[model samples]
Target: MSHEIELKLALPHRALPALRRHPLVSAAQKLGNAVTLDNTYFDTPALQLKARKVALRIRRQGRRQLQTVKCAAVSSGGLSQRPEWEQDYTGAFDFGAIDQPEAAQLLARHHDALVPVFTTRFRRETRVYSPREDLRILMMIDTGEVSLHTPDGVERSAPICELELELEAGQPLDLIELAETLASDLPLMPADLSKAERGYRLFLGTPSTAVRAEPSAIDATQNAVDAFRTLAFSCVRQWQANAAGALEHTDPDSIAADFIHQLRVSQRRLRALLKLFAPALPATFVADWSVRLRENANRFGDARDLDVFHAELFAPVAPEGLADEASFSALASTVRRAREEARAHACHNLDMATQGRLLLGLTADLHRLTIDSLIQAADLRTFARLRLDRLRKRTRRLAAAAETLEPTRLHALRIGFKQLRYAVEFFAPLFPARAVRRYLEAVVVVQDTLGFLQDVDAAQQRLAAWVAADARLAPAAAFVLGWHAARYARLRRRALRESTPLLSGRKPW
Candidate 1:
């Protein structure tokens, strides 16, 4: 499917309102007599997201281009969202547009008999763009009216402000080379901000330059358990979304790789949320599965990494035109052989039948957790209290469990901790939970220890590939020894910093 190139020039605020009313633009629709419906805005609060919008626009049938411009401006101050993606349709929509009313009457409603009114859509995104002074970017001036029409032909218009920029889809982003082929000549500047979230500009808020507060989380405890439950529901909803895409994945390798990554993240977050609500549930209830999933994720991650190295790094380095090029030609040949072996290793692990079975099993577990029956107890108030108590007790148990665990098994133990933490999260509304605040502090401590370990592990694997493939550059490979030493030193410091010992009892394993 080919994509359209769209350029939504963020109209200067001072110029937009007058531009809308200009004779060349407005007389086409006879706007003086049109019944205009005001603009409406939409967003998901739990996601801490705001939407920008475009007016409903259309062009006449015989009026040159069969397209209209649309807009959506957006901003955020919180941590980046986890790995979520909108649908992957990369198409664009826009053109020589007429006002909302006339376009529908002249082109859509009546032209159906002679012309085809195709809705070729592309996914729209609105993300905050920071300002850069070097670029002569357009500054926000003021808002123009955004009008809508009801099914009964009643129409309304509302004043809204926004900053908008549109571009042709799949265009190469060339800041230097070949920049002329795409949306070039555009400069950059600080987009101003507006507090009012409505109308046509609703998608691109009124522009201001004041720095915003880091988006602190909503105080779910103070708001009531029902509010915290909203987060729980959102998490479960995400799991279902993953499940819905089950069979549609034509590429098993990409799908498996994605699922494994999501599993790791879900486990980490679940642990964090469980810790928040741990004052309630039984510690034993979710501990085991956490270990299992984390181990599986690590296993899958290893396979995926090897897959990348095998595919990406196996090729011979582009000949650098060395005077003695043949001196290292054999080394490249050796690297290619290693790459084939690494690819075989990763592929053997990714046998779709086996991976699919694991995914199906994981999906079943998620369904069990998300089913309405498991959640339907009573009103939000009652549910909140019950969940709090269950999760609190469970958390203390997890904290104690973490105090034990052998070094080799720490990954597995963390998994157990995560599951209980997530279950607690599931029922967070029932308690006066200080989990989010407390855990935010605890995470740094845990990651400093555990995270350092994982980083060194990954780094070691990456550096080892250079040694295995480039024996001729043995000195350069040995040069990497300094980095290895640095990593080991960091690893030692990480080991020394954690207060918890790896073993509390006799080795059960």
Candidate 2:
């Protein structure tokens, strides 16, 4: 049994020429000529092994056959460290080489039921990257497809073009550093999916969808710094997943709106986490990432804003009874055109090289981040309590000021509510679940009410510009605002009323 530590990057097929032409690639010693590898993955008809996050595959290279057993591990930002067993496969199944008790038992029990589930055939070009005496990395470029064949002889497949950087000897950070250096010029994006994972998805016929934020796995036992690292890495996973999804489709119409929205959410969550744990983190780290995340998020802001405007604001307006049908139709057309343009812009700007560098650089920094000795000794729960208390107090002050209903003050209150809500969600696991859930439910309501108000306010400015550009849109804009007028006013009052109990109530932390 051996632990495999490697970083995988997805490369655009079109960028193969540039990658091969790279100075580093040219300088590295080629292990051999590219060879085709045909591999078959096996699992029970019921996929018992897959259920346990285990993969069994047999590879055929020339006349030699090798069987490998791999178990999934914590993979983030394209880097993974997992245990695997490999041995020669003469004919029948073999679990004797697998040292892991659970895996060995499972494989032995289901050996007879195992069947070929999927096949991956790819040409792999292997090279040895040895930049230092103590460092050795294997750079393998694989280009092929993962395929599934039905009983009816029909075949379905997905293209695979990726580079795997396996660390033979050296730190994981060096792998990420090398990836960052390569991504500086090539169109490389860190990919968290393994070939086996891709094969399973193909065999199961699962379509790719937008990745949403997952609950942070921070625990009470960890120090403040460790907890923050756990939470921060969670955010990075969300960010990386969405960024990859957004880049998967080149067509503007094919890009999902949720992809962009969730990407922004991840960035915002990361920024909030940095601020929430700033005292324990290096000042420069917090300050630098805050700005970078904010700037990157803003690139897609217009697309999301327009999506909400069209979906929530305009779609609900009943132009049937109160406005001219022609004017409303024209306004709708303008909104759609503007939205398409913004979407296209966003898709175009989602550059693989740029996003790759950002992810790899941030991931490398995260791996190298060191906590202050004093902070490392502090209790995470106590730290969470103090942070939550500060956020709650600040939100209470903003809520009080928002009673005047001043747009600016209301906006500030909205931001405060958001930060407070995020902090609550982040620290919820450290407190009593019931109390945290109740408090979180209230915070979401207040935050959502404020969000609606803010959206309406933002819509007014955009709608006004449209009206100014075309006089026919004035009546339509008026009707749109008038339609939302009552609810907006009621929510403004409700924002303050609902937040009172939440801010003044017993604290969860």
Candidate 3:
């Protein structure tokens, strides 16, 4: 059995020419001949092997056939480590060379039922780079498609364009550094999805859905930097998972708006985590990444704003009469067109070259972060407590000043609440789950109320923009403006009432 350590990157097909001529790739030693790999993945009807997190595949290169079994892998920031056992694939199934007894047993039980599930045929160009003494890396550029044959004889395929950096020798950190340097000039994004995973997803016909933050288990004994890495990685995974969905669909009109929303939320969560750990982390690094994240997520802004207008402001209120209905219909039609335009703008920016680079840069930054003295000396519990108290104090002070606060100030309070909530969620395992839940519940009340107020303000702006853009939308926008304005006082009251618990709630930390 041999362990495989590699970093994967997803690139746009259009960027292939630039990548080929890039200094990094051009400087690397060309290793042997390029090979065309035809790989067939097998699994039982019930997908028992998939359930076990095992992959069985047979690859044909020229006249030689190789059978390989790969165990479950640990992935973070597009880097993966897994154990693989491979041997000559004769005609029949080969389990004798399988190193893991449990995997071997499981394969043998369902060996007869195993069938070809999917295939990936790609031409790979190989290059080797010696980053430094005693450290060598193999760079494989693969371009092709992953296809699955359904029982009904339908074929479904998704294009594949990727770069694999496999460590031939030396430390994994060295690999990360090399990747970061290469990506500094190239449009590259770290891809967390493995081809096998993508193939299985295609075979299963799984549709993408909105993903939320999962709980991060931080050991009390862990240092601050490691805990931050754990939280950062979790947030990165959520962001990338949603990003994959966004990239898979080409038609912006048909794409789920939640994909963009969830991606933004994930990016926001990472930003919040950075703020919470700013003192312990490199300040310059954190500041640079925050700006980059804002820039990247903001690319999807207009689409999201239009989506909110359609979903929240327009859909809820029905026209009272025919005149109102005509006006509303015109307004809706105009809004839909505007949404399509915005979606097009967003999609154009997110295609082949730009989509993955920001994400890859983010992943590379996280991988190369160095723990400062403060972080190394502090336990996660101590650091978390300090962070929570600071945010709580900031939140309360803002809530207290809410009476005379401007809309922007109120928005600031909402941001504070969001950060506090995310911090609580990130460090929930450090404290009791029940206590954390109570704290989160209180924070949610304040955050939701403020969020509604902010949304109303935004809706008003959207309505004004629509009315200004088209005279036909004037009456409909007026009706919406009147309807929404009347509720502002009520919304403010609710926000104030809900702000009580958050301002006065005992700190769980």
Residue 278, candidate 1: how far off, in angstroms?
12
Candidate 2 accuracy as lDDT? 0.90
lDDT of 3: 0.83
Candidate 1 lDDT over 1-509, as tens digits, reads 12222222223235445544444233322212322222222222221222223223233322233233333322211001111111211222322233444333333332223321111111122322112333221112223454444346655544433323222222212111111111122221112222222332323333212121122233333332334334433433333233222212334433444443453454455445544543333345346545654554454455445444334333322435532344345544544555455434444443333333333333233323422333334355454445544444444455455444344344444444344335434443344457443543443455445544444455456656765765564543333334345655655445433423321211111
Q: Which residue segments of model 2 deviate by more than 4 Å?
A: none
Better of 1 and 3 by lDDT: 3
Q: What C-alpha lDDT values do all the predictions have? A: 0.35, 0.90, 0.83
Segments in model 3 whose C-alpha atoms lie over 4 Å from true places: 96-102, 184-186, 322-326, 372-374, 404-406, 469-472, 485-487
Q: Could you tell me the TM-score of candidate 3? A: 0.92
In model 1, where do residues sit more than 4 Å from their true spots? 1-233, 240-260, 267-299, 303-435, 458-481, 494-509
lDDT of 1 at 160: 39
Positional deviation of residue 441's Cα in model 2 after best superposition, in angstroms: 1.0
In TM-score terms, candidate 2 sits at 0.98
Query: Residue 499 in candidate 3 has what lDDT?
Result: 76
Q: Compose the digit string of candidate 3's lDDT tens values, residues 108-172.
A: 99999999999999999999988578989999999999999898999999888998999979878
Give the clashing residue pairs of candidate 3, or none.
189-356
